[model samples]
Target: MQFEPGDRRRVLPRHLRPAPAPEVFAYAIRPARPADLPHVREIYNHFVSNSAVTLDERRSTIPSWREKYALLDRLGLPFLVAVSPSGAVLGYAVAQPWAGKNAYRYTVEDSIYLGPGAGGKGLGSALLQALIEACEQRGIREMVAVISDRGAEASIRLHEKLGFVEAGRMGRVGHKFGRDLGTVYLRRALRPSRPRRGALFGRSR
Candidate 1:
């Protein structure tokens, strides 16, 4: 995909524009790198400071963010980012093990975050679809998304578009900023992959 300079959020960085332009908004979903932390954190902090997308209000530093990637990498989890032709990060997506038991090994929890300017575009869906592909490649069978109340509609709509169904809704489960937030669980079952021969190692596996 190719994005014109004016179409993307920020000035395209030289390294990020690895391709030519296309008719649609030019953006690509790629494996996230440690060097992309700053741009990723900027978008994430926007959600943290201004919205209930995340329960955390504390700001994230590069070190803390890197720690998260390290943990995910160690667990063979998926962490991806959406970047424009100019290198601006438009969004990020990830999946984490859903539970600690062996029975839960095939299930994973997923999340998607888009930068402020990237909303309303196909970016969110692209990020999610990429995450879904990553999970499918890794043999993940079920994926769950716990969405904040305010994001329920958009999240549900996206998940539905990707074949997810509403699993449950928990009322007043989390309090952030100054209001109570409801959590909605959306799930999608993926095709099975090669079975593991033995138990996997990890606290959340």
Candidate 2:
């Protein structure tokens, strides 16, 4: 059987880690609507045009990206955009179900894309934090990040600071831009679904 674009072939993993306070973002977090696809497209295309954040070297079109958003949204996953108060989309982030297997429902892999200006600021963290919260609300157990090993120091560091730990690294699993590349997997567990007392939610029930 052939899997669809967002379909996975394995089961989700179990994650049982503590939850933290509301993540601080220099920008605001909001769900990505269909209208936001253009901004999302631009942000992602920048990475494809200039970075190794994704193995997909080809520039993605708005329709293709919208399809991804629709799939994840249908799965109850969060596809968010971090925008400036003036409404400029700085970055985007979301998690996709890890595997198609029933047991893998709780395990999801994460992805993030940001414009050049969005880096060095708190945009990525803000987006990640929101995604984490969204996952926890849906009873998601584990979130994984598969990052390319080339020039990804900031991404690796951000995940580390966000409570994810290095799980595994596969060497030379990808070849992009005419060079062999490695990728690393990082994971964080979100348990109990509820935020702590006096936390961002203000006295968790």
Candidate 3:
């Protein structure tokens, strides 16, 4: 089966949907919508301004993020969000091309972020796991995470717990927050027991 452009169906399979959040934080994880972009941008821009988790020097605007979100939709990639029962966005995760060239079509890069009040509550894990499962369903073979070296042990450990392995580390490759920063690259393989079927990257069979 194939998904058409702009399909609003859930990106993850039923089996991959995360279990209910703890009573203290009831939330649902689902594919992103245009209305969610403002909250998503808020979470991401927080990282952009306060941490090295993302390398963006300038904060992202909603308009730019909208373009990115649409591109991912056209590419059939997953961009998911965790939303509270009250409609607050707790976190988001996305899968993008590892490289722009066609040779890297089978590989993707993942980015995950949570709101300041949402960490250590299992939201990140749940979001990333769903993203992984969605990519697997789409016939992707590998997922890579590029993490900042400073204060990144938690991020590294989170990825490791999810079965990703340290692939490489680029030393002092980025300058941010008035200091040189390094980056850690982690990768996870997603090939399943049965060979994948259907089209990838929006290519028809």
Query: Cα deviation of 56 in candidate 1 (Å)?
Result: 1.8
- Candidate 3 ranges beyond 4 A from true positions: 1-23, 192-205
Cα lDDT of model 1 overall? 0.80
lDDT per residue for candidate 2 within 90-192, as digits (tens), equals: 7788889897897898899989888766677666777788788888877899999999999788899999999999999999999888899999999998873
Report the C-alpha displacement of residue 56, candidate 3, in angstroms.
1.2
Which runs of model 2 end up more than 4 angstroms from their true locations?
Answer: 1-26, 194-205
lDDT of 1 by residue, 53-147 (tens): 78777988889889989988887778888887788888888898897787898899998888876778777777787788778777899999888
Per-model TM-score versus the true fold: 0.78, 0.80, 0.82
**Residue 175's lDDT in candidate 1:** 90
Best by lDDT: 3
Native-vs-model 3 lDDT?
0.85
